[model samples]
Target: MTLLEQLGIKHPFLLAPMAGVSTPELAAEVSNQGGLGSLGLGASTASSAREQILKTQELTDQPFQVNFFCHQPAVLDAQIAQQWIDYLSPQFQKYGATPPEQLNCIYPSFLDNDDFLNVVLETQPKAVSFHFGIPHAHQIQALKAAGILTLVSATNLAEALAIEAAGIDVIIAQGIEAGGHRGIFNETFDSSVRTADLVQLIKKHCQLPIVAAGGIMTGQQAKVLLNLGADALQLGTAFVQCKSSNANIAYRKALFDQPITQITASISGRPARGLINHWHMQIDTPERPQVPAYPYTYDLGKQLHAAAVQHNDHGFGAFWAGSNVAQIRELEAADLINQLVLEMNFA
Candidate 1:
């Protein structure tokens, strides 16, 4: 059977689970249109994640995926975090807000959080996907026992092999062209392979279904990946302009009106692609300090972003996007899905 048949979906499109972007309304619209919609629970608490899942269920009976960050908790150095805050204080001052006295990483680990796991079990989503890394064997066994199909992102052949060996049902082949944080397993972001190359490599090495991602915006691009042996296509930036996305005015306007550039590990200590802005330009200075790791660095980043937003500044926010963001359109989720399906059908 085809991968879509196994997932019980008619279309080969899967919405990328973008934190602060994919809302329940968007997920429902895509699922209701016979495609897989996803809710990103990476930055959310168990209660919020469950609430989003339940809300999506209320809107559609179709199957959808819920994604989590299976990230290990980073050990924060008080000195380093304080240094970051000190460096960012000037930006805060410009906005007339004082930085928090002490910075804290507010994100909890999904691996250790039983509450989040229990909610997943209760919701029994059609698929559960992981970014950053895969779970332990016992955790994988538990999810499989619950009959939840699994998917994970792989940046290289080694990570792809690891996911297949761990018994994940499908692989999301995320290329360097993908926006946001990469899904490399314990590897630096610089090691990520391009999508076109990674998809072809995985097809030769793994039996699991491959879903190509990154830099895919139009029907012609989607057709290129699908024809290259991708069982499905996962798109993030393409859907950012959809009406249901939780993108604020600044973010959506940036997508439509601005040009994006690739930056290497300057903001989040992990390489990410987004629109060029004042924050990135300043951070790129010769005197810029080393960034803290993952969630720890992200905490300080969020504070700066909050301050920026309050002052109507777009420079500090994490406005992530893929290489093909220029092709994005302001359409409703259902209409976008319909157009993609029409393109795929005729291609």
Candidate 2:
């Protein structure tokens, strides 16, 4: 079935989920305008997730996806984690704040999270997506039983094959240039594939429908991937500049004003594509070999970022963006989606 037919939307374009960034208003506005809207539930609690899903449902009857992180629970390295904290001490002192007394795992993988599963079973969004890794059979079955369409990200062909074997409905071919998290199962995987190449690689091995992602910043780029066999396109950075997004002024200005970018593991202890900032520059280096794991290191990163922001410094913020960030424009969510569609000549 066509992506639009399955999702009941006019455009095949999607508002990709961005944790700590995408809001219900942004997702709803895009869905209302005939694009798939999404909420990043990777960092949300079971109760808070339900509230966000319910709120999103209230705004639009269109199908919207709820995304979760299915990564393994972070392994706490007490000594290593402390080293990471100490490394950021100077940055913290610069803003007159100190790191947390201790770092704690802020988020758990959804693979075996009962509360997360129960929330999905109770307030099932039309679709659910997983990142970092695919869930077990039982969880997949539960989501299927709840009538939720399933999607998962694959940075490489190996992950794509696994997603198909696990009975997933769609594969988001997340390329190296994509903003935010890398979604690689192994944090150390050599994932340097581009968006189009990754799409072709997945197509070569899998028949499951593909949603091309990564730094696709324009309709021309989207068209290239769709022509290459992508059923649709999932976009994150493109929506970051929209009026409906939750990006603060600092984040917005940084996306445009800051030109340098990098894939740093320092921000959240995961390799994610974001604009280069003081935090990444000061902390993410060759000498800084390891930090804590995914959600554990985020506690320290956020601490310093929050402290800096309070002192009117924006450089410490996590301003995630794709390499195509230069094309970003200020527009309403619906308007932005509309422009992309018009540029693609689908309007």
How far is each candidate from the true structure, as Cα RMSD in Å? 1.5, 1.4
For residues 200-279, could you state the per-residue lDDT of candidate 2 as single tens digits?
A: 99999999999999887778888889888899999999889887788998888887887567888888888888998875
lDDT of 2: 0.86
Please identify model 2 stretches exceeding 4 Å from their true place: none
Query: Residue pairs in steric clash, candidate 2?
Result: none
> Model 1: number of clashes?
0
**Top lDDT prediction, candidate number:** 2
Candidate 1 collision pairs: none
lDDT of each: 0.84, 0.86
Question: What digit string (tens of lDDT, one per residue) describes model 1 on residues 1-347?
Answer: 89999788888899999988999999989989998999988889999999999999999999999998877777777787777778888988999989887766766667765777788899898998999888778778878999999999998998899999999999999998898878866735456688999999999999999999999877778888988889999988988888788988888889988857565565665567787777678876778776777777777778888888887887887888988788887788888888887877777
Q: Please report, as a residue range, the 10-residue window in candidate 1 with the lowest summed lDDT.
A: 261-270
**Alpha-carbon lDDT of model 1:** 0.84
